[model samples]
Target: MEKVREFIVIPQKKPETVRDLLGWHRKLLFDCLKQELKKRLIESSITELNRLIGKMVPSFEGEVLDSAAKLKLQSINELLQEAREELLVTKKVIKSFYKSNETIIAAIVKSHMGEETLTRLRDQHEDTHPNLLHEPGWMLEYQVAKEQWDKGKAAFLTFGTFMDPAKADVIVISNPLDEKIEFNLDWREIEESRE
Candidate 1:
């Protein structure tokens, strides 16, 4: 008989707002969810491979070198190659999940943070990354904005629910409204792109 280790999880600060809830959930469970999903995927794949190899082993017990045996070996090799490919794909899926989730979460938080909160956040970021202020034109702008806009356009495009269509209508503007600048949105282009 084996004894399993018992664990107890203690809850921390309670969340007051949706932003707090999202932040807490990400901090507490996002990494765990990613790791658990990866673990389960890999475990199932290994179990399937082992079961396949086990079933195929009996056929090779007393078999002499023949075309059939060679075919079986080739098939096994193909399965192994597929498993390798699947692992690579698994990595890609996990990476995509990490990137997309971070962006979506940031978008939601950004919406909630508004101008003042973002200004404070930006101040903190600037304090930490003073080098960003010195970089050349586009690079400087990109470096400063990258944190706020992680796949910003793509994330915003898919943001919000059908039930709340208004939330999804994100408009990007460079200059302030007071600035003498003409801004136009082609509704036809937007509709075509959505399709």
Candidate 2:
């Protein structure tokens, strides 16, 4: 088994009301967080092994499997079913959070730049191009992602001076939210808090 590197995000600064926040700052921070988190999550999986065992209980081979093999397959299937159920719930929660974030970013944009500017930004975001790296309408994506990272919500990366997770995150606790929250990295971990 290969040991994968893990990174956690701990916020250095958090804006309460988005008073002076800008979309580009969000973009920069969110992009860095995203890359770090993604790099951490690519652990080994069983897809190849399951596919290789043809004619076995878990494979497409039309042969009869032994009792032990059948039991192993059954166990794996049960685990997969449980994972799927959890995934559905997590997806729902994430989607809802992102939707709320869109509204929050829109509010911030309108507050700073007015409704007309917000409308134009939305239009630009909707007009996605294949090669476009950053959005002409930067308000939508970055704000939510950055806000989440800023708020110290990403499981894998910790805020503060960048420290590698191999030594356990040495986070300088700043955000009150960070002090109140923790991540177990078990993937089944979900956080809920009152606003």
Candidate 3:
């Protein structure tokens, strides 16, 4: 099991103005608080989803238990479809939660830190990182960001429920570990291609 580590940042002295806080520090606090709220909401949805999975799994046992056990694609599809819908709604709610709370959090940060610090922080770009799981292709994305970062270009975040691959200026898709060969054509015009 993975341990959930939480951090609390306490200022040594009372903050007289927002300027006392470095821009990254303010972002860290904001991200921490926002992440916690997201965790609670996402956990609730996952708990129910897990329960549904438990109840539904036995229903599939029939296909393996008996020689005559049948495969019911409709039942399986319906189960997955429901799960997808639940997750999609959860994703939407989480994104909306961030959108709504960010402003209030920013205001609080500005009050404690100051308007100038907030302004600079908003204008600054930060690196994007992967979560603990380090989901596939994250490092690739980080690398791409780093390339842009090295050239003194800004890297910003875009929050959404789905990827707009078509509109993305950069895309990094890793091939599977297994060997593969494909004779195909990519119609899109790409720049700075890499292997």
TM-score of each: 0.33, 0.40, 0.31
Question: Relative to the unseen true structure, what is the C-alpha lDDT of residue 194 in candidate 2, on a scale of 0 to 100?
Answer: 14
| Model 2: ten consecutive residues of lowest lDDT | 156-165
Which lDDT tens digits does candidate 3 get at residues 1-195? Answer: 223232223334323332332222334335544554565565666566567666756887745544333244445456556655655654454444334323433444354457785565555532232231134443455466457546544332222101111123232222222323221113132221321
Quote the lDDT for 16 in model 2.
Answer: 35
TM-score sort, best first: 2, 1, 3
CA RMSD of all predictions: 17.6, 14.1, 19.6
Candidate 3 or 1, higher lDDT: 1
Q: Write the per-residue lDDT of candidate 2 for residues 5-72, one digit (tens) a residue.
A: 33322123333322222322334345544533332332112343344343354463676877887787
lDDT of each: 0.42, 0.37, 0.40
Cα TM-score of candidate 2: 0.40
- Residues 53-166 of candidate 1 have per-residue lDDT tens digits of 778778778867588767876787687677666666555544443343334333344565565654554454332311111224324333333443453321122111121122
By the lDDT metric, which is better: model 2 or model 3? 3
Top TM-score: which candidate number?
A: 2
